[model samples]
Target: MSNSGWTSIAETNIGTVRKVNEDDFLDLPEAQLWCVADGMGGHAKGDVASQLITKTLSDLASNAPEELSVDSICDCIKQTNYTLIELSNQHNSIVGSTVVALFFTAEHAHLIWAGDSRIYRLRSNTLERVTRDHSQVEDMIDAGLISPEEAETHPKANVITRAVGAAVELDLDVKTLPLEDGDQFLLCSDGLNKVMNDLELEHALKTMDTKTISNRLIEIALNRKARDNVTVIVVRNEKQIEEALHETLPLDDTLPLHYSNKS
Candidate 1:
C-alpha cells in the first residue's frame, strides 16, 4: 500500500468451480468506488441483471452530484432497478440482483446495499460487518425465532427478502463512516459468507494482502461447494488525507482546500 492519495488495489477471481459467472464488479477511479453485485433471478438473466446494475452504478458515480449524499446513491440504485425491470420485461425474463457498494472519498466512506451482499470493515485486526442482510433468515434472527448460529444452516438462508428488480420500488440500505490509515474494507457476496465463518474471514483478511486474501477466500468458498456466486472487493487506506494531497501536489501550485471527491 502506498501512503498517498487513496492508493488501493483490488483483485477478483471467478472461483475455481463455477459454471456461470453471475457476479459483477465495478472499480471507478474518480470516486474510488468499488462495488459487487450478485445476481439471483436465474439462468442467463441473472448475469445480465447484475451487469446492468454495475454499469448503471458506474455511470452514476462518474457523474455524481456535487454533494454526493446517501440519498443520491439510493436514487441511483432505484434508477438501476427501473432499468433492470424494464430490460426483464423487454426480454420476457425475470431478472434481479443484490448490490453492495463502497464509495471512498478523501476522508470518509459511504456504503449502500440491497439484499445479502455485505460490507465489512477491518481495523486493529478486528472485523465488523457494516451491512445487514435483507433475507428471511435474518428477519427470523432479528425477531428472535432463531439464534444467529441456526440462521447459518437454515434452509431459507438463501432466500432474500428484498432485492433490486423484485418489485416496482426498491429500498436501499445506506451508511457512512470516517476513514483511517491502515483500515481495510471488504465487500462480498453470499457465497463467501455462506461457507466461511466470520472468524475465518477476519483472520484471512487480517493476515493477507488484498489480492491473496481475495483469492484465498474464494478458494475456501469453492472448496465448501458454495452453490451461489462468490465475489470480494478489498480496500485499504494507506495514507492520511493531508499526506496524500501533499504527495501529489505540483511544486508551485497550491492544493485545493476542498478535497471532496465522490465515487
Candidate 2:
C-alpha cells in the first residue's frame, strides 16, 4: 500500500486538422486513468469504434468491483473486449481499438495494454518504456532483422499484431511497479511515441504539469506529422508522509446524539 498525497489532471485534444477525436479519459477519486484508441478498418466507423472502447472502459472503471486486484482489472478488460465485439457485430463493421490504461494507488501503479499504445515511467529525469509493443516491427527488432533506429522508420511499424476487437479473446499485457515520490507515468497511443523519442518526451514531461504535458505531447506528435489519433495521461506522485499522535480526538458535535454518544 502507498501513503502518498498526489494531484493529477488529464486532457485530450483532436489534432489540428483531424475531423474526429477518438481519445478519452477516466478520472476517478481512487484512480486516474486515460486511454487512446486509434480505430482501424477504415471509413468513419473507425472513430466510432475507438469511442466505443473508451466509453466502455470508462463505464467499467466507474462500476468496478470493491476489491482492487489483478484479476478484477483483467476481467474489466475482458468485458470491454466483449462489448466491442458485440458492437462490431451489431454495426456490421470490422472495427477495433488500441488500448492503454493506467491504474495507480498509493503504493503501486498497474499498467494494462494492448496493441501499440505505450506506457512510460519517468524517474530521476530518466524515462523508461514499461510496456512492450505488440507489433510486427517490434518482433523484427527483437529477432535482429532491424536495429532500434531502423525499426522506428520501418514501413510496417504501424502494423500492430494484436488489439481489442480483433478476435473473440484478447490477451492483455499487465505490469506492476512500485510507487515513488517525484515519479511520473505516461500512457499514450502510438501517435505520440511514433513521432517523439524518449529524450524529447522526457523534456516535454519535465516542463509541464499533467494537463500541459498531455497537450504538449500531442502537439509534438502533430508537429512531426503523425497521422494517427493521439492520447496521453500524465501522473506525477508528490508523495507526502505525515504522522500524528492523539490521546482523545473530539467528536463532531453536528452528528446525531446517538452516534456522537458512541464516540
TM-score of each model, in listed order: 0.81, 0.80
Tens-digit lDDT track for model 1 on 54-150?
Answer: 8877777767646565677678789889988887688776689888888865677888889999988877678899899999999999999999888
lDDT of each: 0.73, 0.67
What C-alpha lDDT does candidate 2 achieve relative to the native structure? 0.67
Expressed as tens digits, the lDDT of each residue in 33-88 for candidate 2 is: 55656666353366666777667666766776355556666676677678778777
lDDT of 1 at 24: 89
Q: Which portions of model 1 miss their true places by more than 4 Å?
A: 1-4, 9-18, 41-44, 63-69, 91-93, 239-263
Residue 219, model 2: lDDT of: 63
Pairs clashing within candidate 2: 2-106, 2-107
